[model samples]
Target: MSHEIELKLALPHRALPALRRHPLVSAAQKLGNAVTLDNTYFDTPALQLKARKVALRIRRQGRRQLQTVKCAAVSSGGLSQRPEWEQDYTGAFDFGAIDQPEAAQLLARHHDALVPVFTTRFRRETRVYSPREDLRILMMIDTGEVSLHTPDGVERSAPICELELELEAGQPLDLIELAETLASDLPLMPADLSKAERGYRLFLGTPSTAVRAEPSAIDATQNAVDAFRTLAFSCVRQWQANAAGALEHTDPDSIAADFIHQLRVSQRRLRALLKLFAPALPATFVADWSVRLRENANRFGDARDLDVFHAELFAPVAPEGLADEASFSALASTVRRAREEARAHACHNLDMATQGRLLLGLTADLHRLTIDSLIQAADLRTFARLRLDRLRKRTRRLAAAAETLEPTRLHALRIGFKQLRYAVEFFAPLFPARAVRRYLEAVVVVQDTLGFLQDVDAAQQRLAAWVAADARLAPAAAFVLGWHAARYARLRRRALRESTPLLSGRKPW
Candidate 1:
């Protein structure tokens, strides 16, 4: 499917309102007599997201281009969202547009008999763009009216402000080379901000330059358990979304790789949320599965990494035109052989039948957790209290469990901790939970220890590939020894910093 190139020039605020009313633009629709419906805005609060919008626009049938411009401006101050993606349709929509009313009457409603009114859509995104002074970017001036029409032909218009920029889809982003082929000549500047979230500009808020507060989380405890439950529901909803895409994945390798990554993240977050609500549930209830999933994720991650190295790094380095090029030609040949072996290793692990079975099993577990029956107890108030108590007790148990665990098994133990933490999260509304605040502090401590370990592990694997493939550059490979030493030193410091010992009892394993 080919994509359209769209350029939504963020109209200067001072110029937009007058531009809308200009004779060349407005007389086409006879706007003086049109019944205009005001603009409406939409967003998901739990996601801490705001939407920008475009007016409903259309062009006449015989009026040159069969397209209209649309807009959506957006901003955020919180941590980046986890790995979520909108649908992957990369198409664009826009053109020589007429006002909302006339376009529908002249082109859509009546032209159906002679012309085809195709809705070729592309996914729209609105993300905050920071300002850069070097670029002569357009500054926000003021808002123009955004009008809508009801099914009964009643129409309304509302004043809204926004900053908008549109571009042709799949265009190469060339800041230097070949920049002329795409949306070039555009400069950059600080987009101003507006507090009012409505109308046509609703998608691109009124522009201001004041720095915003880091988006602190909503105080779910103070708001009531029902509010915290909203987060729980959102998490479960995400799991279902993953499940819905089950069979549609034509590429098993990409799908498996994605699922494994999501599993790791879900486990980490679940642990964090469980810790928040741990004052309630039984510690034993979710501990085991956490270990299992984390181990599986690590296993899958290893396979995926090897897959990348095998595919990406196996090729011979582009000949650098060395005077003695043949001196290292054999080394490249050796690297290619290693790459084939690494690819075989990763592929053997990714046998779709086996991976699919694991995914199906994981999906079943998620369904069990998300089913309405498991959640339907009573009103939000009652549910909140019950969940709090269950999760609190469970958390203390997890904290104690973490105090034990052998070094080799720490990954597995963390998994157990995560599951209980997530279950607690599931029922967070029932308690006066200080989990989010407390855990935010605890995470740094845990990651400093555990995270350092994982980083060194990954780094070691990456550096080892250079040694295995480039024996001729043995000195350069040995040069990497300094980095290895640095990593080991960091690893030692990480080991020394954690207060918890790896073993509390006799080795059960």
Candidate 2:
């Protein structure tokens, strides 16, 4: 049994020429000529092994056959460290080489039921990257497809073009550093999916969808710094997943709106986490990432804003009874055109090289981040309590000021509510679940009410510009605002009323 530590990057097929032409690639010693590898993955008809996050595959290279057993591990930002067993496969199944008790038992029990589930055939070009005496990395470029064949002889497949950087000897950070250096010029994006994972998805016929934020796995036992690292890495996973999804489709119409929205959410969550744990983190780290995340998020802001405007604001307006049908139709057309343009812009700007560098650089920094000795000794729960208390107090002050209903003050209150809500969600696991859930439910309501108000306010400015550009849109804009007028006013009052109990109530932390 051996632990495999490697970083995988997805490369655009079109960028193969540039990658091969790279100075580093040219300088590295080629292990051999590219060879085709045909591999078959096996699992029970019921996929018992897959259920346990285990993969069994047999590879055929020339006349030699090798069987490998791999178990999934914590993979983030394209880097993974997992245990695997490999041995020669003469004919029948073999679990004797697998040292892991659970895996060995499972494989032995289901050996007879195992069947070929999927096949991956790819040409792999292997090279040895040895930049230092103590460092050795294997750079393998694989280009092929993962395929599934039905009983009816029909075949379905997905293209695979990726580079795997396996660390033979050296730190994981060096792998990420090398990836960052390569991504500086090539169109490389860190990919968290393994070939086996891709094969399973193909065999199961699962379509790719937008990745949403997952609950942070921070625990009470960890120090403040460790907890923050756990939470921060969670955010990075969300960010990386969405960024990859957004880049998967080149067509503007094919890009999902949720992809962009969730990407922004991840960035915002990361920024909030940095601020929430700033005292324990290096000042420069917090300050630098805050700005970078904010700037990157803003690139897609217009697309999301327009999506909400069209979906929530305009779609609900009943132009049937109160406005001219022609004017409303024209306004709708303008909104759609503007939205398409913004979407296209966003898709175009989602550059693989740029996003790759950002992810790899941030991931490398995260791996190298060191906590202050004093902070490392502090209790995470106590730290969470103090942070939550500060956020709650600040939100209470903003809520009080928002009673005047001043747009600016209301906006500030909205931001405060958001930060407070995020902090609550982040620290919820450290407190009593019931109390945290109740408090979180209230915070979401207040935050959502404020969000609606803010959206309406933002819509007014955009709608006004449209009206100014075309006089026919004035009546339509008026009707749109008038339609939302009552609810907006009621929510403004409700924002303050609902937040009172939440801010003044017993604290969860």
Model 1's C-alpha root-mean-square deviation from the true structure amounts to 20.1
Model 2 per-residue lDDT tens digits across residues 140-254:
9999999999898878999999999999999999999999899999988889988888988888888677788788688888887788888888888898889988887779887
Q: Model-by-model lDDT, in order?
A: 0.35, 0.90
lDDT of 2 at 250: 72
Candidate 2 regions with alpha-carbon error over 4 angstroms: none
Identify the runs in model 1 with alpha carbons over 4 angstroms from their true place: 1-233, 240-260, 267-299, 303-435, 458-481, 494-509
Provide C-alpha RMSD values for all models, in order. Answer: 20.1, 1.2
Best by lDDT: 2
lDDT (C-alpha) at residue 336 in model 1? 53
Cα lDDT for residue 127, model 2?
A: 94
Clashes of 1: 47
lDDT of 1 by residue, 1-509 (tens): 12222222223235445544444233322212322222222222221222223223233322233233333322211001111111211222322233444333333332223321111111122322112333221112223454444346655544433323222222212111111111122221112222222332323333212121122233333332334334433433333233222212334433444443453454455445544543333345346545654554454455445444334333322435532344345544544555455434444443333333333333233323422333334355454445544444444455455444344344444444344335434443344457443543443455445544444455456656765765564543333334345655655445433423321211111
| Sequence-dependent TM-score of model 2 | 0.98
